[model samples]
Target: MSFDYEKYIRPGKLPHIWCPGCGHGIVMKGLIRAMDALGMKKNNTAIVSGIGCASRLPGYIDCCTLHTTHGRAVAFATGIKMAKPEMQVLCVGGDGDGVAIGGNHFIHACRRNINITYLIMNNNIYGMTGGQFSPTTPTGAKASTTPYGNPDPPFDIAKLAIGAGATFVARGTAYHANQIEKLLVEAIRHKGFSVVEILDSCPTTYGRRNRFRSVVEMMNNLKEIAVSVQAAEHMSPEQMQGKVLTGVLYRDNRPEYVEEYQKVIEAAQDFAG
Candidate 1:
């Protein structure tokens, strides 16, 4: 049976603004499925996002959504999560919005290990903003701003999330649509801060500039280069070269920011009494 996506999407929001062949649509479908599987209540969930193609996801979803300023998704989501710890606050954004201008906020949110989930769509380019090279743009990749190819090294999103102290970190590619939902499900179920990086494709910008020939080729490349974490463990280091690891790369159980903050509040209340 086909899933009822309309139930989750806002009415009359169809004919989305995303360009044809963009992977953002696929990513959104995966999220909808994950939310359905988890029985997420739309009224009790707050979807927050910064400016970008991926961030626009919250606008189309039938939920309490916030389309905030550029690169401040995490910061705003943090405040929402703290103010209403009972709500499931999920932050969404693209590479530029989440890791470039929002880099400081991203890492600090991870450090706090707050009860919020961040879903970052790493298309490697700023698809919505002039096709500029983003923080995750691979060195030598072509973008509108990098006519001669990008000189800066790309960030390993999963590694950054783990290094920054996020309690849960996972990776999925748009090619593996099913895996995206699974990763998101696990991320949401985790207690503390969770980061799921979805390697999406911006066929209009990144693909056209990099000579991928077609969107299919770009998506095929993603499939060919991804290795599941379990499979990667059995492969030699040399064999794993040029291949990105998929699935949950890191997870830890620790004190969540909200619960810990409540302790301070309790102590203050006792002193006052």
Candidate 2:
């Protein structure tokens, strides 16, 4: 079967706000392709986003989109999913939105195992907010706010999601276009809470401040520093110190919160009888 993206893209929004070398565009394409492959109905799907360049995804998609307050997309999406379980709810946001201001919501949503897909664009800095350090920024990565080099360790997003009770967790990068799309399709199809961390580039903020020279150089570094699960297990402390994991790091079958809630309602009626 063939799918037409033009039909689902909002008109007059062709010129995106991201920088020339930004990776959000690649991630967006992956998502659109995955939805099309899954044959998701645009009307039946809802895209929720928080404040950030990545959050603008909802505005570009031709669907029931909600560009909500900063770091609150997950919370808002939770309500929407509970009210309408059949909706194909997807949340998009940046590292700052998902793991900094919204960190609490991110973990709780995973623990609740709400049936929703969260695509976190982890560009390592707050690109939309002037290149500030985020929860996912490396310990030594330079940012506008971290002039003398960062002092805090970055959060491994996939590991956090897995530990927080996300039934499905995956990691991909803008360079791995095909893998991202495939993973997104599986994430959306998963019956429990799913999280995919897409490592992206911020040419203007992170690139310039960190001496990346260009977006292509940043991507090359990403490819070189990334490690697979199997490779990570064999690496020593020195080798693993600066490494990042990619691919489907973890997944499992768990009872979803919404499905369990319905069961409770059914049990209550039986007890009343």
Candidate 3:
């Protein structure tokens, strides 16, 4: 597939640093395709990332990218959006960075309904920090730190985003490359806060010790488990158990953060003037 790489990719950054079979590359491809579909100007876009293997996305995209501190992409993105409302801001991070350390900011960002798209590449474990069991690591999954199987239940990121007031919420896996791109495009076009939880695979860290034959096998497993929203609607509780839902889970047209702030400013001005 020939894409206008010059338009969305930085020069000399070809061949990203991600390990072989790492789904971050596939996820980045989807993101670039979505940007192309949206016809968004690279100059007018900002991609922010927190510390993690998935945080390397901003470095590959030709935009106003910020590789911020651990679990702080939301705060950085919020500042970027507030400073330049006209710019389209996208936040990228891993499950641990966004849902664990950055959980507070993530919730607040959803509550604010800021015009930003957050892409969380969830590979189930903390890939960057040596495969520790993260907040999204499935219960009973074994990580380096959880050699005996994790005792804690993992977080449901999509539900959390929706409950926190995110206007648009979607889920896609790296294996479903085309669908991931489509969902990303929709998320970017949405006017309010949007979150797309991408099920990615970390072969070296999360896959090797988890009994996944290879990255390919893990991706195949994701395809097997993912179900579309349309399919989920008719699925019985027994049938839906342990299945991950792909596609848009929820969406709503809500007043954006900046727009609401503007309204408050106007009202205060009217009272004072």
Candidate 4:
């Protein structure tokens, strides 16, 4: 059955600002499908984003949305979650916005195990900022700032989230639209902090600089390199080189911050009584 995506999108916001062939639109559609599948009420859900091309998504979504300062989406989302623990809060950001300038808040949110979901659009370059190499940009990849090719090693966002103590961590690509939606639904249902890293393509910026013939070529590359976690288990290390392991990377049952704080409040009331 076809989903009514218009129900979730703001009507006047049609003809979004993203460039033609940009993968951000696919990621946004996946998110909308996930919300529909979960039957999330717009009134009870909040979307937050920082300054970037990908952050513009909230402007098109029909929900309580916050367009925050650069690299501050997580901080603002944290305040919203604390103020209304019953509401579903989601933070959307680009690779540079979340993993570079906002790296501190990102890890702390994971360590605290807050009941919030973070969807990071990792396109490997600062698409809105002249195509500079981002934290997740592959080593030796050409970018506006690295015309000679980037020499720095890129950070694996999934590994970083797991190391920072996120309760749930997963990876998906824009090429796998259905899988992205499924992973998002599970992430939203998880009790503690959840991070879903989406490997999206910025055809206008990253693709042109990387010598991709077209958006289809870039997408095909993603499909070729992305391997499910289960399939990866059967491959040798040498064979796994240059492959991106997708699917749920890690998960654990941990005490969420809001629930733990409520316990303290209950204990204090009991003592007073």
Candidate 5:
């Protein structure tokens, strides 16, 4: 069945700012498709984003969206979820926005197991910020700041989220569009903190510096390196090198923070009575 994506897009926000051949558009489409499949009402959903190329997504979405300050989208989303626990809050951000300056907030949100979905577009560079290297930028990859090569090792967003106590964690790539949509649906439905790290391409910035001939080349590279979780288990460590495992990496049904807090409040009232 064909989905009328226009219903979820802000008509006046056409002509998005993402560069040609950028993978952010594909990720956005997956998000919209997942929401549509789940029958999510725009009014009941709140999309939040921080500053960066990927953060611009909320502007184009027709739902209740918050384009927040750089590295603060997660904090703002946490507040929204706490204030209205019933609202389905989704936070979108880029590699830099989510794991660089926002690193503290990101980890805490996972530790608390907040009932919110966080989609991190890991394009490996800060495309909007003059193509600087980001936390997820692979070690030895050239960027605006690292003209020679980045000396710092990259952070695996999925590993970080899982280690930080996220209840659900998964990964997907722009090349696997259908998988991205399915992962988003699962993340959104998870009751506790859920993080989906999307390996996206920034052809204009990251690709140009990394020697990708075209956006298609970058996407094909992602497809080549992507392995399913089940397949990865059968592969040796050497075989897994440089390969991104896609699919649910971790999941646990811990008590969601908001619901647990509510229990505390009720218990206190009962004690007073």
Candidate 6:
């Protein structure tokens, strides 16, 4: 049977505001499928996001959703996870919302090994708020703010997450729709801070400025540049220079922050006694 996506979506939230050829819709559908695969109930799941094109995802899902200010999604989601550790907490946002203004929160959450999943949809440009250049916008890429070319170095989000001590880190792309759900399911199942950086497309802003002929070209670029983690091991560094590795990138066994904090509470109680 075809996937019943309507059951997971909110009533009357149809017809999203995203522009045509946008991949945010695809990512949202994948998240729903992932939730279904895990048998997660709407009451038991809390999806949070910040201000951006991708941040609008939580508003459409039929779950406990928190839509916060720009770059505050992870900070808000962290608090939610700490209070209700049993709930499946997910933080969703675009590249700028995740790593630009919220970079500190993102790294600290990873360092604390908080048991929350963050899905960073990197479309290279800040598609919302006038299509400015974001932290993930590649060097030499053009944007509304950078008409000549962007001089800033782009961030490799997966590498940044791993370096910041996120216990589970993985990557997928809009072109690989089949793999997105699998990656999300694995990230949600992990016991510590988990991050899934999905390279998505923003054809309306990024493509138009960067001279991409169409959304198909952008999607095809993703397909051509992505190399699976397993497939990358066999290739030489030269062959992998321009390729991005997909799949689960790194995982480590770490003490989750919420469980550790509980110990502190117990210690305080015992001291009072």
Write out the backbone clash pairs for model 1. Answer: none
lDDT of 4 by residue, 187-250 (tens): 9999999999999999998999899999999999999999999999999999999899999999
* Prediction 2 TM-score vs. true: 0.95
**lDDT per residue (tens digit) for residues 1-273 in model 2:** 565778779999888888898999999999999998899999999999999999998899999999999999999999999999989999999999998899999999999999999999999999987899998888988998899999999898888999999999999898887888998999999999999999998989998988898788988977887887778888898998867788888889989999999999899999999
TM-score (all chains, Cα) for each model = 0.98, 0.95, 0.97, 0.98, 0.98, 0.98
Q: How far off is residue 36 in model 3, in Å?
A: 0.7
Displacement of the residue 27 alpha carbon in candidate 6, Å: 0.6
Deviating ranges (above 4 Å) for candidate 6: none
Poorest lDDT segment (10 consecutive residues) of candidate 3: 1-10
lDDT of 6 by residue, 73-122 (tens): 88998889888888989999999999999999999999999999999999
Candidate 6 TM-score, C-alpha based: 0.98
Q: Where is model 6 poorest over a 10-residue stretch in terms of lDDT?
A: 122-131
> lDDT per residue, candidate 5, 212-253, as tens digits?
999889999999999999999899999998898999999999
Model 1 Cα lDDT, one tens digit per residue, 172-202: 9999999999999999999999999999898
Q: After superposition, how far is residue 165 of candidate 2 from its true place, in Å?
A: 0.6
Off by over 4 Å in 2: 1-3, 230-241
lDDT agreement of model 6 with the native? 0.93
Clash pairs of candidate 6? none
Weakest 10 consecutive residues of candidate 2 by summed lDDT: 1-10
Reference-based lDDT, each prediction: 0.93, 0.91, 0.92, 0.95, 0.95, 0.93
Per residue, candidate 3 scores C-alpha lDDT tens digits across 221-263 of 8999999999998999999888999999999988999889889
Off by over 4 Å in 1: none
Error in Å for residue 116 of model 1? 0.5
Query: 2 or 3, which is superior by TM-score?
Result: 3
